[model samples]
Target: MKAGVFYGTNFRIGQSSGGLPIIDNDDIPIALVQGNRDGVANPANAQETYAGIQDPPKAFITIPGANHYGITNEDNLIREPNRPTLEQDVAIETIARWSALFLRGTALKDKGAFDYVFNSGDALDPNVSVESVTKPIPEYTSVVSLLGLGVIGASSLLTNMQKLVKKST
Candidate 1:
């Protein structure tokens, strides 16, 4: 997450020439798929962040026995598997199913078809997910990513300085 915003929240849109005034609020309906293994934006804190959302109605689903990337097919990424059951495939399928229904409903205005999504406000699993709204929203911060940018920039500057020194020599 950058500047207190959640990870992957830094999105931008441009006009034909990529000029503004930029339109931020498109009032798009959203469906939140929270991995049980994903400590960030877990169901509970997700509900809180979602509650603060000014966009259209939304849906939040927490797939049990999974982590932040539970939707992926990486079996080895499982957190502490010896403890709770890790239903990885089920979580992925569940997310796909909910996304399809939610998007279809949003597009076709078929609220009745996706009414179950309204229950997104429900409590999160106490053991794995965040149970308190007061805490910051959990996110998968790419530590290497944040550091890589600076490292790369510094390397470029040093390389240029070396080239200039050799040229002058």
Candidate 2:
């Protein structure tokens, strides 16, 4: 499960002779974090890039009331003035938490994290607006996997039974 994280990314910057490089890559799972109030990097560019992805799990998270420099410690208004309702600390914390969850879901294959990121939990968060595309869980491709799960379950049951027997004795 190869995965990637991008924060405040400008998809429009590419040095290719053809101008902007293709944003679509179906092989790697990716999480892109953006600020809805960003004045520097246009949110439209991120939206376009996210739309181009055809397959593989992907998440686009827009931090509400955050600006382009929200990922940073402070926004230097001289570089890019922004109107951000979210404080820097709050924005940073939100980005960190979501990014970690995204990595755990995709890279570590953690079901709880995956569920929150790609399923219903993120929708309830007031700080973010999430758009996600999920690859279906691959079918069990081999009998070994089924057998392995069965064995683990049996072992757990046996251990619990032994503990109960000891307590009764």
Candidate 3:
């Protein structure tokens, strides 16, 4: 999945300098993983950004008791001091699992991954709170489907063109 993943960051849209288009305008799925205790980027800003995205296949995941630096090895409170109640290892593992599941679900088009991220499996994680918009898609049952038909089709066309060029030469 060509998903845009944001971790404890904020972007200003519609500004003259360094502004971006509305998040919903993006075609790819978006996931924002925020720590509840983040001081660098306010959690409220994350909420606003998530609200701006008016499309399905989007996710807003919050890690409870985690600070802005919780995703990293240690929390640095030099600029924005916020204590994390969650342990570093625990937060990292939680983030890693969810991120992987999200990628597997959207990019690999795996039904189980989809179920975990967009469906009921997310509830198993007590430390995470997820709000998402998602729709059902057909299960991909083959290696070709896993690779995506568009990719394979393009590769085949390119190979055929190369063969024709070789024969001409």
For every model shown, the clashing-pair count is: 8, 0, 1
TM-score, each model? 0.46, 0.73, 0.71
lDDT string, candidate 3, 1-169, tens digits: 3776678876642232443346663557777898999888888778877877766688888999888887899889796588999999999888888888888887778889878888776588898999988855557676558668879889999999999999999
RMSD, model 3, all Cα superposed? 10.2
Off by over 4 Å in 1: 1-24, 40-45, 76-84, 119-169
| Candidate 1 structure quality by residue, lDDT tens digits, 43-150 | 455554455544455544555665655556754434423222567676566656655655655656666644534433234223122221221333556666768888
lDDT of 2 at 116: 95
The per-residue C-alpha lDDT of model 1 at residue 144 equals 67
Is candidate 1 or 3 superior in lDDT?
Answer: 3
Report how far residue 7 has shifted in candidate 3, in Å: 1.0
TM-score of 3: 0.71
Q: Candidate 1: what lDDT?
A: 0.48
Candidate 2, residues 53-159: lDDT per residue as tens digits? 66669899999888888888888788667778998999999999999999999889999999999987566788988999897665776667888899999999999
Off by over 4 Å in 3: 12-21, 136-169
Compute the lDDT of residue 157 as modeled in candidate 1. Answer: 100
Residue 71 of model 1, lDDT score: 56
Mark the 10 consecutive residues where model 1 has the least summed lDDT: 1-10
Off by over 4 Å in 2: 14-21, 24-26, 137-169
